[model samples]
Target: MNDRKPNLRSVRELTPALEFCTIHGYRRAYRVAGSGPALLLIHGIGDNSTTWSTVQSQLAQRFTVVAPDLLGHGQSDKPRADYSVAAYANGMRDLLGVLDIEKVTVVGHSLGGGVAMQFAYQFPQLVDRLILIGAGGVTKDVNIALRVASLPMGGEALSLLRLPLVLPSVQAIGAVAGKLLGTTALGRDLPNALRILRDLPEPTATSAFTRTLRAVVDWRGQVVTMLDRCYLTESVPVQLIWGERDAVIPVSHARMAHAAMPGSQLEIFERSGHFPFHDDPDRFVEVVQRFIDSTEPAEYDQTALRQLLRTGVRERAISGTVDTKVAVLDAMGTDERSAT
Candidate 1:
């Protein structure tokens, strides 16, 4: 057995500060830092506030960085109830109400991105600006790898036995076997899960794990419905940041977002994966700062700014579609035409 420690560069930068809030009939934990316009930081699936440590630290100089460990992940509670984007958004709503922060700039990544979009839709008055990083709300295009992970038999091998309903003896055996060989294989498809378990604060690991899994399967339906239409009623200064190499939620989703919200500004980073902040923290910081700095740009020049929206609409207009199978596999019914 390889007993060497996992190479974790992400958690090293995290400065965790705890806060308690109730969500889904359970007390949840979150981390808060800095002070300015309330900036609620949301994380992707299988990750916690720690994933935003690098980006949050940079933004803290200009905004209050509020990164929460979503319900059932990180230090939060993990109940047996099904989870969904609406649940996560409601969890956020409860958190914000408890904090007494009326309006905020919500930044969500991956699953958190989907949650952020819903939050904006449900509580438009509470959100001042929106930033979605490789977000998954607007498009039904999900990674094949993640879809595979959702299957009963295809999940992490240890998860097969560690189920909340499983026998203790079987779970124990699976835990031992999992510690030996299961995690490595699971990490190949679910990178963030491996990262979450390794970086989990304490006893919260097991529950958070279960909750995250439940959230994934439950959130798909409602989120897909929300994405079919443009949710924001008023212009709220939307910004999108996508990784060119994102395998989890392809950058194609950004294109969909641009099409849906024609006013949003999109930034695509080549060579970055699911978590572009990990790939290039400095560049991420720069892009976000630029967006915030130029927020007050001339209102009359909206057309020029709209033209600069980088969610790949112009590119899509040219290329049309990458692969028809992507649409069929995602089950996102839409007009399909082959690229010339």
Candidate 2:
């Protein structure tokens, strides 16, 4: 029941109509348009909700689209806080509560996909449908460049990229180097380093990015995996989308995740890369529309959740206690000594 009005604009508009909300002392900014069942769009690391620019309006025709700039990125306030997936999930829940929107069809890209999965895990009742695009939480095999950036020494190196004073000079040099090298991987090591450099010039954004990246990634590729817990979403409708030409996180992850969850749907964009939604916005929107139209929203059981929690207790009872194990060992020792 927040009386404050939300700032909104259509995709057809030139200047963006961004909205702001103060949630628990943090200034959270988001954009909302159209109306129907609520839809939450989450952006990836180092990127904001602007990444959803291509498809947001088109989808808004049928659904109420709520795309927020995650805390520590874009217009949102960046504070020294826990940047873990669980923390983000809780934040999303709180944001929705503040807006008074109960249920949503959650759509996330890359790092946002990890957050979306964690949200569903933490608050299954709030999630109606789940969609992941080029998600990072399904596999261990991430690009080596990202893994390297997760190291302790990587922070010092990354700081140079955030020097706003020197960015113009760097861009000038980069432009000169680019013409000679063309669009090559070495020209821009990560999938979107050049874009990140341009978009996220603030020191706070850089710091948040570094902290966020290290939490889920390490020198050994991605440290977080949703493969083990994907079964929990069995009752909920899940969709996996990936670019066939994706070099950042590889389409293999989508395949693996799709295989792990037999009930989920998989769509591969043949001519797309890391950002498939951008590669073919119309097709992406069409696919999402079709999926939403075809599937029914999830109806989770509260009793099943309690049952799932109680399983460990039953398992422990079957396995016996620490005292029982010690007692058995003592009895074996007694029998052996007596026989000897």
Candidate 3:
């Protein structure tokens, strides 16, 4: 007998694997791959667990990787209600509960980062460590256009009625905009930005882009404040991964987060952009693995773990076998520019 690889269909196919255990009310689709201690991965807006494919593959060798699609995004059900960060966090908590995972290191990106912060704050006992990659919840001032686009009327503004043949116009404008925009303004390197946009899944009526925008705009300050309080109370070890060229949520936010959570570690990816994982998976995995190794529970079987985490546990954090240099921002600095 042979076991065929699971068919990679639409995002919805991921649900059956993840819903292996009962999560009451919310049907969150998830998948558990590799073997070892559990590591829960939550993705940001407009992305699914597939985004973590590379990192998950590497980490799975060391731990049982549980990656879930947030309610509205991947294969999970999208309800017809305003999505709040708190709700998303709660959903994750329930997902873990049903999956029989009492405690695990939680990793989140962009919007998912905010969700992870909320979860760690709300259920500190359940979270061993927190890893945030370009997470949100710092400020309201996002991209000026995104800010405008998120408004109630903004969605209408994007329709072809406002600008006939808008999609074509957007493509043309994006081309010229790329030329005019600097690295600091484009959010990512021109090539990377183009790649990200080009690679975005083809839009369907149910794409959830607008819904994600609403969540991004609405889910703000309150969650961060709660996370700050969590840091003060629990002080769970935090690992922050940031891209130097990320303009969507500036690296300045990481500085603020480090100050707010004194115990947190910050790693800035130089010459990298918004989606650092896409640009440099090895470095991302290195830093995350270090944080996990630093905080792994003693109860877990070490010898078994060695088999799980393929690479040596003591390998360099940001660099693997070869040296990879990076410019880091000192959290303790008063001058933010000098720090970054």
lDDT of each structure?
Answer: 0.64, 0.77, 0.62
Clashing pairs in 3: 18-30, 61-308, 61-309, 62-308, 62-309
lDDT of 2 by residue, 128-157 (tens): 999999997765678787888889987677
lDDT string for model 3 (20-130, tens) is 333555456777776567788988766777778767767776677899877766666666644667777788888887777888888888888888877775666687788
* TM-score quality measure for candidate 1: 0.70
Per-residue error (Å), model 2, residue 49: 0.8
For candidate 2, the 10 contiguous residues with the lowest summed lDDT are 331-340
lDDT of 1 by residue, 155-214 (tens): 444354444544455445555554665323322223444455344334345444545544
Scored by lDDT, model 2 comes in at 0.77
Q: What is the total number of backbone clashes in candidate 2?
A: 0
Range of the 10 consecutive residues with the lowest summed lDDT in candidate 3: 331-340
TM-score, prediction 3: 0.70
* Candidate 2 lDDT score at position 91: 89
| lDDT at 131, model 1 | 86
